[model samples]
Target chain A: MCGIVGLLVKTPALKARLGELMVPMLIGMTERGPDSAGLAVFTEPLATDERKISLYSGLTEEGADFNWLGLGHELKAHLGIEARMAVQGNHAVLTIGIAPEPVKRWIKEHHPRLHILSTGRAIDLYKDIGTPTEVAERYDFKHLTGTHLVGHTRMATESAVTPDRAHPFTAGEDFCLVHNGSLSNPYGVRRMLEPRGIKFETDNDTEAACRFLEWRLREGDDLETALQKGFAELDGFYTFLMGTTDKLALIRDPFACKPAVVAENDEYVAIASEFRSLAHLPDIKNAKVFEPAPEEMYVWTA
Target chain B: MDSLKFDLAEIPLRTVNTFLHQEAPGQGVRKVLITNPDGAHNIAVGLDFPVEIEIVGHAGYYAGGMNKQASITVTGSAGTGVAENMMSGRVHVKGFASNGAGASAHGGLLVIEGDAGLRCGISLKGGDIVVGGSVGSFSAFMAQAGRMVICGDAGDALGDSLYEAVLYVKGSIKSLGADARIEPMAEADLATVKALLAAAGPAFDQYAPQDFKRVASARSLYHWNADANQEY
Candidate 1:
């Protein structure tokens, strides 16, 4: 079983402590998932023309000493675009002025081993192969400031424990999903999406679901409509938690084979696979704690 | 007898459970107060005594599992399998409960003051369950013997394949499983609901025994028909 946690702060003041508040929530699920940990946080958006790409150099040869500024300069020279990067250990968030397709392709061409974690105006993602505590310390998750975040701890069942295979899987941009239950027909869903030109990143089942839902959203289906289709086509036991630019959405399969508990107050809305992960939240005693029903869509806006 | 206190914030749950298992009885303790449970799993499990355990906060998985004579009470919500596989005693939750709330119990009274998630009393050998609120899908599947009193609605597939176990539901039932049918409630069913509701608590007293409907199995799957070509 994997662990999924999400926190959406309604009060603007609580946004400053988003990541700090989520650290305990993520670490609390250590018993459920102990292999790898990851999170996607939606921060203040950048300019309309600028898109930030979160890159992980953990698998690179140089590892922690990977040259992020050097890549920025190379991008400036090759693509004639000013790229500003915030270097953090093996992870970096690089902001580029031009469109992201060429820059992403260039990065893939030059640094094939470097994994692109996410790309969007509001999202900066970090995921790695380690325990939740180690991963949180490595990325300094406590210092991150955002309106909302989705975190995951992995207990590998259907796939290997690679950083790219870790959760908060992204599809187009600003859209991420974490799954708890296993999908019975991921390959069938893959065949359905591959013919439509959706290239998969990993053989993991959760990625297939993530891409399918995001592709539906990109195909002009509203969130609710796309999720209705997801309920129809995606055949498996899943409690999916998705995060977009301004919304956090959740849905369970028809059977709700997986577990999920939600706690909401005037200040924040927190979700976890179990109540243990959310026990440490402030004022949680007064929160409206409840379990989400099967085949029901729950959405919260920032 | 003096009541003992165990603060989970400062002490590990093992110490409390060990005390309950090893020394609480010898010390003449009849009551236990557990504070800051914080949804920790296995708060007071495997008790063979008649001591009363009061958990001040939420409890995690299997809070009162395998109980013999102990009476456990949680002031807040309980996680999955709160009183699963209980032999005898009483488990009470003041708030809602997660999946498989009272699964496969042999004997005891499991009370959820609020709702209970999917498969509330699956595979029950013999036990009594009183749900003050709704119960999710697949409640009381494949029960050998026991009874359940549901004050609120029930989700899909209530009592799929049952044996001698009866369910009294006051609210609507979404669907009934195969071989399960709604029959007229006799005087015995009403009396059972009355006794179970009174045992549940005063809050459940508002629900009258006559308001409930009885659901039981048709016993069609008791004997197989080989000549029918494997169709139900």
Candidate 2:
């Protein structure tokens, strides 16, 4: 079991206050999930010549003050590309004036202990094992500014309670997902994706779903088509909230076992496992609140 | 009569549910008014005593689930699995309900004033369900015993693989399940419908007892045969 909250700000004026509005939404679901929490925020895109890679370093013995500056120097030497780095909590965002693919390969070979949580022009991912409130504060979520965000609080029903096992699992560039229910045939899906060169960091079912969507997008299917195919291929009860650079998409399984409520206003579109998480939003009384039907996909774009 | 009012905006749902769970019957409080529910799941589950719980706004999944003797009422729409596995007492929803309402309930009365979503009475044992509006597809599937009355149209595959239970629909049925078929209404059937309508309150006053059509199991597939297995 887990709780998922997503917000897509339609009004550009409210973009900078995304994190302030999202804090309560994430904390409201603390009772549903208390093990760990993760969030993915999409802010302004990087310059066309640059890319950003968010990496988690808690696994290192150095803890939160790990040598990110030294790592940046090493990357510059190893790849012969200039890079800048900023450390927040246990995560470090590295912006490099180079393509992302080779940089990702360099990191995989050099720093196997570091986990690349996200890599995109706009997305920054942070996750840790703590209460939603604690994790949100630790990452300075209230001060973070973004156009859209996806967050999750996990209960650890199927996987160990570790940072990597936490949700908002990233797929393609600037694409991430948070799931509420367990998948039945994740191992089978993993086996299918492994041979296609899709790497997995954890044995969690949501990772398999994330990788599947990435593979589908790689195969030239749009997000809507991939989700429609997922309903036929994936066997489980799930409510998935997926995020991309421009869109926030939601879909539920045919049975619709998990609870989900969506509220939309002229300012923003919000989704959560329950309405209580959304009740405190601005102009909520005027927002349209409705439960998304089974096998239906709803999308909000920025 | 003593009544207590709780505003969910001022308190957490867990705290309110804990208080409701600890309260004993006939101790003093006979009614509870919960305001600003705002679609929180599992509002009043496992309630065994005879008390009245009136929720002022929309409720989330599993509202009043596993109810025994409590009479719970929702002023707005209810999420999935309302009154699920209920053993006794009553649950009333003033607005629409999501899927699996009253699923696997053994005994009780669940009344929905508006439309019910898919699989409304799946695996019902003995509970009596009344829907004022249309019910979605695959309702009453694998129902062992119970009674379901739908005042509006019924969606596809109504009463699939049903046994012993009786279904009464005042409007059209999209289709019947494999082992279920329509039956002739008798004097006792009219009496049953009339009593169920009365129990549902005055909203159903215009529905005459004769308006319902009875549906039951065909009994042809009771014992599985090698040839019959091919059809499945």
Candidate 3:
């Protein structure tokens, strides 16, 4: 009982309407996952010296009324860097001209409860504890513009239904993964990754998968090779959909215990756990729709 | 004698299903047209009236389950369990089908013009399936009776731990399950493939009867081997 959705527009013109098209797709899976929903959209890249961090204040004491401007000024006075921000409800994207590690450390030290969703040059993530429609409306997902995005609706079988535990789990930078099945050996994976200086944010099993794959990417293994290692190390019934700055990759477990359907055309590639989420797309009748085979990686470039 | 039409976009699924269950038999609506199926689950399920259902678009899980004396056709793909536990009549899909396409069916015929997903006919009591495209792993697992004709390749463990149900495949098999072996196709097996292919419609007209190989149980696992220490 989880739902995963990913969309990457091949035609640059279609990027403007990307979020608008994805709203219905996310809402359609509300039945499969009604507890919480989230997504990470990959927009145009930032300047070479700049990076952006997606911050969530839902777990904070101030909630939606958190003073984002004060945080920007604090960064300027304390860290000697100006931070430009775009705030929406409890979520905000803070773009800065410094590495995200120290900025993240500052936020962790000062605003301990503020959850960092993601930090990258091209990705802006938003997730919260609500229905898919509520979360989409909360973040105004319909107005988002990007080349691609990965979204998820979770029913919370393996972890508590908290804002931080909701999916599109990110690790390292500019990478995220959403899962639709449970892992049998998440503790084993965590034990393996923890020894290598990787830190975990939540006890959710999907985080382990997200961090494991990203750690591999950081180690210079290409996406396909890392996934091959994943096939050997990860043991579970999973259909994991991963998002990078330039690609959207999907894979099902050997048994395909979880489902994924891919619909592709000249303009875009859309993936969902079921066809219900994709029936509203334009020219869906002519789309080359098919089910990705088990243990096979299908990667689409944006 | 016009066909009955139901646009799922405007009318709720419960309304359409209610009509088929309560009012359709008495009204003599021989044909039912469902428009914009949009991967909606349980469309035209549990029918008893021998009515002809034409789904104009993709249907979700269990599109035509537990059917009796009905003919259902999906113009697009079908989700998991397209025709599970069907009692009689025919259910056909013009496009690909998700996992467990015709699982545990009792009688009647199920046809897929495209690929069928994993465990397509698991735990089948009886029924017949004809897949024009490939079938995923573990198809026809533990099937007790009836027949299956796959015009394309089969994934790993084609018919593991089978029981009486026979399988005919035209293409390569990734692997066969325990006790399920490719036996010499007898004259009866060829005739069965011929009849099933014809029943599956024109899309299967190209597959000759002799082109298929028969897979059935070796009956090795039928009884417990007390002397063989946990090895099959």
Candidate 4:
């Protein structure tokens, strides 16, 4: 088993406090997984094209439009500067770099199924295997500044011990995901996505789900609709943590074999594999902490 | 002498782990009440002070490893390697202990209230160990010193290659090792066994001083004779 943690805050200052705040929680969970650790922080009101993009839903595999023409190079030419882009949950995150309002407006106009979850600065990323302390020291996470953060500690069962196999995984410019537990039906999902020219680096089932969600969101499906529809297709135990720049989402499998704890307050929202990790944080007392109900999708706003 | 109560579901395991610094400074005798009926692992590890630990349910592996001066009492069946590598202090299992109980023990007393799995007193050096129930195979495979008294039947190969340790089994023996042989339970031996039993706690009341048999090594493995009938 591995440990996963995500926190969403309303203020940018909380983003700056994230690294230091998450370090102790991560340290407390070292025994669950002694392998690699990774974190991704997101800022809202991103400057890239939020409308002309489709989130990469990992549900539908084949016949999805991944046509690069007039998508990548054309957008750069239309816009003055380079756009910050990431792929997550079948949606392409296009930060216009300079102006986020126009890009957010453009995304809302073109893709009705997709909406801007967050409007500030959004960061989507993935990292490799190690203890939480090792990762924090190596990455200097104690000094990083952001508004939203997602982290994962991996225990390799299906995938090989490589950096590529670690989470949080990125699909395009806008989407990222982290997962706990094994998926029994990854091969079936892989068969659907491989034909669409989407290649997977690791044998882990979480990546397969990521690819499927990416494909669906690109086709104009809302995050909740796509996730609700995709939930039935997935088999076995899984508790997923996903996010865009503006919002954080959590999903638990039907069986609830895996564990996910949530602690929420007016200032911040935190999700972790164990209550001890969340309780270890400073100034986190008197918060309402509880385990998430099984097979439910919970989304939080920054 | 402060007492702490740990309830089952409300208990956080990390809280217990963070506080277990028996070798650290300023730690003293404490009374812990385990209100949880469920089993947990690493209940008391690396303890050096004389604290009283009372567990109400079954315990998992290495119940008391590297123990010093504390006394641990378990009221249920113990998992594997109970009291393993015990340096000092005492560990009393009110019920059975799984395999390799008291393996490589250095000092202190290990009293088992019920049966013991294989290799009960393997590699025992010092300390007094008394088992109220039957012992599995290879009870004292390489005992160097100390004393082991089993009030119940002992399994096969009781003392394979023992040194100077004294073993007393009150019940039937399947086999004896290289130099191990049965000896008459003398008055001094009975007195020692009775004292050990009395100290073993409430579960050891039915033990009788007369119904026991004593087994000890004849000091043969220490010196090997080249021309003797022994096979090297």
- In order, candidate lDDTs are 0.92, 0.89, 0.94, 0.71
What lDDT is obtained when candidate 4 is compared to the true structure? 0.71
Better of 2 and 4 by lDDT: 2
In the range B4-107, model 3's lDDT, one tens digit per residue, is 88999999999999989998998888998999999999999999987999999899999999989999999999999999999999999999999998899999
Which window of 10 residues has the lowest lDDT sum in candidate 1 chain B? B223-232
Clashes per candidate, residues 3 or more apart or on different chains: 0, 0, 0, 53
Clashing pairs in 1: none
Ranking by DockQ: 3, 1, 2, 4
- The ten-residue window of minimal lDDT in model 3 chain A covers A8-17
TM-score winner, 3 or 4: 3
Q: Which candidate should be chosen as best, given DockQ against the real structure? A: 3
Which pairs of residues have clashing backbones in candidate 2? none
Query: What tens digits encode model 1's per-residue C-alpha lDDT throughout A1-302?
Result: 98999999988778999988999999998778899999999998999999999999999999999988888888889998898889899999999888899999999999999999999999999998889999999999998889999999989899999899998899899999999989999999999999999999899999989999999999999999999999988988899999999999999998879989999999999999988899889999999999999999999999
Candidate 4 clash total?
A: 53
Best by lDDT: 3
A180-209, model 3: which lDDT tens digit per residue?
Answer: 999999999999999999999999999999
- Model 4 chain A weakest 10-residue run by lDDT: A54-63
Residues A1-302, candidate 2, lDDT per residue (tens digit)?
78999999877678988999999999988988898998999988999878889999888777787788888889888889888887885789999898899998888888787889999999999999999999999888887788999999999888899999999899768999999999999999999889988888898999998999878988999989999888887889899999988889999987677778888888999999887788788988678776777788998888
Rank ordering of all candidates by TM-score, starting from the highest: 3, 1, 2, 4
Model 3 chain B: weakest 10-residue lDDT segment is B223-232
Chain B, per-candidate TM-score:
0.97, 0.97, 0.98, 0.90
Q: What TM-scores do the predictions have? A: 0.99, 0.87, 0.99, 0.49
Predicted structure 3: lDDT:
0.94
Stretches off by above 4 angstroms in model 3 are: none
Among residues 3 or more apart in sequence or in different chains, the pairs in candidate 3 whose N, CA or C atoms overlap within 3 Å are none
| Candidate closer to the true structure by TM-score (higher is better), 1 or 4 | 1
Give the 10-residue window scoring lowest on summed lDDT in candidate 2 chain A: A285-294
Candidate 3 Cα deviation (angstroms), residue B77: 0.5
